[model samples]
Target: MLITEKKHGIRFAQRMSDLGTETAFVVLAKARQLESQGRTIVHLEIGEPDFETPAHIVDEAVRALKAGATHYGPSPGLPEARQAIARYVSETRRVPVDFERVVITPGAKPIMFYTILALVDEGDEVIYPNPGFPIYESVIRFVGGRPVPIQLHEENDFRLDVGELLDLVTDRTKLIIINSPQNPTGSILTAEDLEAVGRLALDRDIYILADEIYSRIIYEGDFTSILHVVPEAMDQVILLDGMSKTFAMTGWRLGWGVMQPTLAAAVAKLQTNSNSCTATFSQMVIPPALFGPQGPVEAMRAEFQRRRDAIVAGLNRIDRITCRKPAGAFYVFPNTSRLGVDSQTLADRMLQEAGVAALSGTAFGRFGEGYLRFSYANSIENIKLGLERVEAFVAKL
Candidate 1:
């Protein structure tokens, strides 16, 4: 007898239905498939850095591995790694962060997952930005919390509207997710904006999860953390950051969270039950990556700024497409509403016809329907080529 669904019962739990996916990875697979079929795809679909890991950071990890540093570490993280994160956060944010408050995970994502799991009760609400990271909503729903989306307007350059966000709050609201130098849109929230949000969270006694993974990838101005603005509300804030964007260490899978010691204990317990701990050698890389030469990171940011400028200019010259120069990150969310096609259809047509791999804005959320997101993480030549293909495809419409 064949093993078939009809012959054997196989079902996912109820919460599985509510879980969503990050469509960038899905588009990447399709792009790779097309490439395997001999199509030349200019990939702007994923947000990963195109650079290699810095030499020093890689050397540190290698040294640790060679010296037999591979062992089961503490659930929260190796003590030295946690201490380095504490120092990094304290110095950078100008807020004193105790080492006890830091918890390391495989990547920045687990911080999001663990924070939601530990804090959100079923029926509690989480207010997060739409056209934001899909996993924010995905993990929110996975843990049985209601996801309340706050629309990010293109007119406002995709910054979160504090007034509008205030309207979404309810007694059941447990946490608010803030992603500055945000994904997809690449907008940075102002210090005043962070102050307002911090005040709201403090007054309402709700938690604020600040996802600042892209803090080191900024352009044009200083990057501000919520903790910097509201050090008084340290207990109410959870800071999420990682080496993926900064040091081109996505493959290394190292990230961390900084919170109050009590909540850190809770998140660490969750880590114990789940991932146990991050890799020991990877943990050893933290001190060097944070305190080592800053030259490599600055070079990457400068290059990304160059790519951002080129992509924005190219997209603007195309008919019916208007793009804003993002303040940070490596994405340009161009408005395609004037082209009279839904974002998903436009994205699909671009991929199938033009060999350009980009994401429909709807992949972020329903509010993203009129837009499309293209990561400028590729080379300037590839970015220009993708723009040409997009323009040619849009002209046909």
Candidate 2:
């Protein structure tokens, strides 16, 4: 009787039982803890830009707050903000979008989730890229949809094979996800690939979600959006873009989704029920950010290009590592298999032994086993130091 005990806590939803997670933040937290203990940790694990938000953007937010823009606005977003987004998309991406089709959310992630929720049903097939953003797969599973992987090979510069992708689509497929200037690998989809997939989407009447968050961070050839190839896809295509990457406004939580009117309404309903709306003051910054002078953005892009060149050159000098100069985005996904260790093991050893923190390829997907993603969004000095530490660690091994 004395040993008898009460029952433990009740079970949570079974859908959440096998949910996956993004590992970038976990590695970031561990790096911070190590730094707190007096360790000099060179962080290459996170995807955030190292620069501050532009002064004009910040000032706009402050002005909005002071001008009494604190009240709850529409759940979809402020009309002015939506109009600015629409205009920006039309001018930049060449996609003629009506302002009524735009829905501003807290960040790009919400748009992904909302789009997935609207299209995916139980057991419905959804195609997404492996070695891509982890959240795409996670959210697909969260909504009881079957996630089909479109394998991206390192030999192909991590770009998707459109023929192979189309071969995997079935009659039950409801949605397909694509990311350009992709995360982790930083591969940009080719115009040919985009055209093939765009035609497929049009023929199959399937919904397409294009994650173009890093559209402005390219280092080489012109950056292209799928919207450019399929201008008529304004209704079926949902384009996700934001100030987070382009303007370094991650903390501001400003992002907008461009979709057809009906889909936009659905997403707005979701917002109304969940987040209510994005922060009022943040919405006020969209106009200035969209139409302001392009000086800061160009400066940041030039700096990122320099850092990319430095990291790629340094990694190429290491005998045991192979990396390509990423076409866009602020990451270098190098194949670490020549080091005689798996990515996760190498990442763990590097963090604890070399005082250099980075993300394992396994954190992205199973296809990412032999690679590790190093974000070059830090200072050039830090990038050089991190590579040196990594080289030393490989030598000792």
Q: Model 1, clash count?
A: 1
Error of 2 at 59 (Å): 1.0
TM-score per prediction, in order, is 0.98, 0.97
> Model 1: runs farther than 4 Å from truth?
1-6
**Model 1: per-residue Cα lDDT over 140-183, one tens digit each:** 99999999999999989899999999999999999999999999
Which of the numbered candidates is closest to the native, going by highest lDDT? Answer: 1
What is candidate 1's local distance difference test score? 0.93
Best by TM-score: 1
Per-residue accuracy of model 2 over 84-190 as CA lDDT, tens digit each: 99999999898677899999999888999899988899999989888989999999999999999899998898999977997999998888888999998899999
RMSD per prediction, one decimal? Answer: 1.1, 2.1
